[model samples]
Target chain A: MLNFLSTALVPLLASLIVLAGLRRRLDLFACFAEGARQGMGSILSLVPTLVALMVGVEMLSASGLLELLGRALAPAARLLGLPEALMPLVILRPISGNGSLSVLGDLIAKNGADSLVATAGAVILTSTETTLYTAGVYFGSVGARDTGPTIPAALLSDLIAVLVGGGLVKLMLFS
Target chain B: MLNKIWAGMILISTLAGLALGRGAELSGAVFTGCSRALSLAVTLLGVAAFWSGLMHIAEQSGLLAAFAGLLRPLIRLLFPGLGRGGGAEQAIAASMTANIFGLSGAATPLGLRAMAELAKGQPRGMASPHMQMLVLINSASLQIVPATVVALRQEAGSAAPFAIMPAVWLTSAATLVAGVLLLRLLTALARPRRQRASEKGGLRRC
Candidate 1:
């Protein structure tokens, strides 16, 4: 039942929007074209950042630094009852969305799709925003020099979310 | 900050490769990384574009505004100082609505406009409490449908792409509540200090 709902969600949403547009007498095709163009532009702008981050993350993993770092942080992760593999994702998540997504892909590849690590990673990714990027853009837009506890508060919240998400995934999915 | 992190990763990776005698492997990783990024982006493009287009239709048909209207009471509670039906209020509502619906392409612009509106008549270069709350809420965005993550999970061949939805919703709500409480606490703590500082300044002037 849940699987069917998930599969139906996108088509349902699309149909609903289209029907609404028709009812409003909108030029749906033209609107879609314009928005799709904007989406393409946004994706293009993301390419460079993705390339840079992916290279860095790949090199980190390929050179075995990630493993070393993971081992170094293993005690802390153990204390939190988290897998060592999730260290990179936890750190990269708040910094870069694409970077964290790359880490998440690697996590799912290393651990099976149904593994606790992958589920936890997915939950964390879905729940948390890219804190640094969001802060930069939101504050930068208004020329606000003093962010005044926004970043710290947000990061604290993200940490709570990540920890809670890992636990939730374990309890909900695995159990 | 991002610059530092990105450069540090490259430099550390190079040094590690040299130390580990994996220069050839490191070079290979560069190509693989770029290709991986491109592939991932290609996978994402279709979903992102389709969703963006669909959201555009929704926006044009006034569906988004209707959703925003539904969020007005919540907005009023979250952003207390905004005048009812004012620009900031409306922008905040729209942005929050877009965010919940996972239309980040629209959310960012609306969020920026809301920030600009909230910043009006505020102290120069200082973020008002309302502005801070706005950014905080955005950073802890409570997305009802995590479309991007679901799409990525699907691309990764997950048997159940939306299996994590319940967890996502739980975590998002928790984080948003925690963030709001923390922001309120910080703002409350800062207010007295600012007032005391101003009092000291007045004394110095006398």
Candidate 2:
């Protein structure tokens, strides 16, 4: 039932919006086209920042530093009752969404999708945003230079999410 | 701050790569990253364009305003300084709506719009507390469905992909609450220092 709702949500939303527009005698096609054009412009403006950020992230990963950082944080992970295998995902989660997704995929493949680690990873991934990416794009759009405690606060929140999410998975699934 | 972080990432990666004799891999990563970002952008373009168009219709039809009306009290609590029925408020509502529905691709465009709106009339290069608050909330995931994670779990052959929904809900709520509280605490802490510094400047001028 939940799966059905999840799958149907987007299409249902689209249908409702269209129906709403029709009822109001709105030129839905023209409105949509104009919005799409605006959307494309905003996205085009983001490309350079995205490229720079992604390159930095990719370089960090490629240089083996990310893996090393993960290993370095393994003890911290263990102290928090998290699996050592999840260290990399934890590190990458805030930096890069696709990187963390691939990491989650690897975790599930190795430990089985139903394993505690994979479940915990999935929960964490779903619970937190890619902080760096989101902040970069949002602030970049407006050319806002001073983020003013935003990143730190967001990262702290992500930490809370990870701890709470992973702890619950351990309590419920591990048991 | 972002500038520093970006430069630091590149510098550290290059230094580490050379030290570890992974220069070749680092160079390869540059091109790979660009291509990856481009492909990601292309995917974002399609999803964002479709959602933006739909949302535009929603806006034209007054559906978005109605949806945002339901969230007005919450918005008032979050952004007390914002006036009623402003562009910022509407964009924020749209962004939050997209976030709750787990339409992140749609959320980004709306969020960017909100940021742009919040930036207006403010001093150049400085983010207002409201803008920072918006970014903080955006960073704290608020999705109910988490469709992407569930779909990925299904692809990974989970017998019950959505079983983790409870955990997701708990964590997302906790994170958002924590983020809000922390931001408030930080703002309160900084206010005193700011005032003292300004007063000190006033004294020096005298």
Lowest lDDT block of 10, candidate 2 chain B: B197-206
> Which candidate's TM-score is highest?
1
Query: In model 1, what is the error at residue B66, expressed in angstroms?
Result: 0.2
Predicted model with the maximum DockQ? 1
The whole-model C-alpha lDDT of candidate 2 against the native structure comes to 0.81
Clashing pairs in 2: none
Q: Tens-digit lDDT track for model 1 on B1-206?
A: 78998899899999998899889989998998899889878877887787778888888899988988999988888888679999999889988988898887778998999999998887667788899999999999688678777877788788888788877878899999999999888877877887988877743421
| lDDT tens per residue, model 2, A3-101 | 466457667888998999999998888989998787677667777877887787778878888778878888899898887777878877898776676
Off by more than 4 A, model 1: A1-8, B202-206
- Interface DockQ of each model: 0.67, 0.50
Tens-place lDDT per residue, model 1, A1-175, is 6445555776787888899999999998999988888777777788898899888889888888999999999998999888888988999888888889888877876787678888898898889999989999999888888788888899999999989999998987788
In angstroms, the error of model 1 at A91 is 1.2
